[model samples]
Target: MSISRFAALALLALPLAACQPNVPQESMTDPQDATEADIARWYIGTIPDDPFDIPQVDTNLLPEEMVRQTVKYNGSEQAGTIVVDIDSRHLYLVQNNGTAVRYGIGVGKQGFSWKGAARVGRKGVWPNWSPTSTMVRIKPDLPRHVKGGLDNPLGARALYLYNGNVDTLFRIHGTNEPWSIGQAVSSGCIRMLNQDVLDLYQRVEVGAPVIVKRTGKRVVANAE
Candidate 1:
């Protein structure tokens, strides 16, 4: 998003925050007091004065950094520096000839597994979760739309997919169900640990191509 949008969100939220009773006086600022840096952070909901340092985890909650030593292979290692082996459920970031830094991944369940090449068309931090019309049709009571937060099924980052110029609505993103790693479990989205997604976000630029080769294709999507 543009810096203006970030500034607008910050300006919007800070006022709501300052309006709450018991907030310190110094925290309050004039309309002119908003700064570019403040806007960037609060827009991202990553305020400097956040209270929590070490995060707390619940049993039902998946730790964002969970790592599994599972096998994974995909032409991702060849996808202009990244490859995701869906069968083995691993994501690879190429560093050199025939070598890459790999991370275990979670995948779509059985019928939901997708195969084909696409590009990272969009990226979002702390993305919101809005079940598709199909998702709601499958389960009527499911929340139609939800904002971003720890409770969101999508974790800290998201990489939206596209076929040429057409949006697929599928994404490579963080998941709350880390236990689903190495398994097909999503409606169609590719999932990874939050730490892994964050790692990828830093490494991949928008428009990077992702080759999601079919299962059992020795050319890509290897279990090892």
Candidate 2:
């Protein structure tokens, strides 16, 4: 190898490195052993610290594990894939690197639970809430339509799921009930804290792949 060739290779590598998103690794901390400062720094790194937003999540209402954290993902899914583990009540957005941004999520109750592969068919920021006919029939008091905003059951964001061209009538959305996170509380939708959902909405685009699993499925690279 010549010095000139090595120098040329180094120069080429510099531009490639610069093109990558600057995802900080130092702030990554284990949720179990993290300090208050560690949690604060990690949270700030994962999402914007917007205190005055109308739909901001109440950190006081969130459990520690529910706070967004970037973790080592041993999964096979490529970057931008969204994996929802129903049993764990966590949604992971696979990153370009070998890691994932995990958010605490709320899944549907027993009979309402489902598992399948779908795509993010649509995205809504403070999207409107419309009770499905089935929901309206089951709960006569439910509203048919509600405008989007802080008070809406959809909260800050919603990602509508679709299997090819068919609407699944399911969503990965923000919830007004933050306390319901990490629980099986939704009629069918997968819910997140408002802030987390907003962050996720920003990262994902329409047509992104989504996998909802009932069991803890291992996503190995070769098998993916």
Candidate 3:
């Protein structure tokens, strides 16, 4: 309890405080003021300006809840689990302290919506996209393959879904059509803003659990 001892202890604590996560302060106070540009930025360096240079998200076009924020999570899922509330068009990444990072999302259109538990089978950055045979059948004008770029349907990152060893063909991915967020428009994959998806890509690991809930199912931790 000596003055010099206390001063030394305070000095030692400075570095730890500096190492804390750099969460945005403004978003927490009032998420209604949040915007896609105000949320986290693209972690990777910007791609060169090309014919398909990345488009900026029009915040005015988005719903207030579509932005990112940290909020209390009442669910039983442990930290690192991803819970998609299709009804609300929000995706929650459960954090360690009974909290979760919530991001607005776009769900699948009418008949394409589904509910299930799956795991992250794989991940990709600036992923190439190809219309599935089913997609091609549905939309004959859809291209067979699309190279990875800002214009690609999968914007900046993608987390592929799997049930055990089976590919579910569902993904949590960035979308070029950011205006579609908070809507039911995708075939089945979950779509996020590019910047938001990039942030999520860094946090999620392969084999992490994902729960997609279209109905009012009670959220819970992944079964062991």
Which candidate has the highest lDDT of all? Answer: 3
Candidate 1 local lDDT, 1-224, one digit each (tens): 33234334444544343333331122312224544433322221222211211111121222222243333333334534556666766666655444556666777776777878788898988888899888888889887776765456677789988898898988888754444655666787888766567768878898887766447432333434
TM-score of each: 0.64, 0.71, 0.72
Clashing pairs in 2: 76-219
The 0-to-1 C-alpha lDDT of every candidate, in the order given, reads: 0.58, 0.70, 0.71
1-63 per-residue lDDT for model 2 (tens digits): 322332233233332443334343332212334333322321211133333143333353455
Model 3: which ten-residue window has the lowest total lDDT?
A: 36-45
- 1-224 in candidate 3: lDDT tens per residue? 32233223333433343333443323222223333333322121233333333334434446667788888888898899999988888999999987899998988888888789999999987889997888989989887777776557787789999999998988999875555677788898899987788889989999999998876433432221
Q: What is the lDDT of residue 224 in candidate 3?
A: 17
lDDT of 2 at 146: 80
What is the TM-score of candidate 1? 0.64
Better candidate number, 1 or 3, judged by lDDT: 3
Q: Which stretches of candidate 1 lie over 4 Å from their true place?
A: 1-79, 216-224
The global Cα lDDT (0 to 1) of model 1 is 0.58
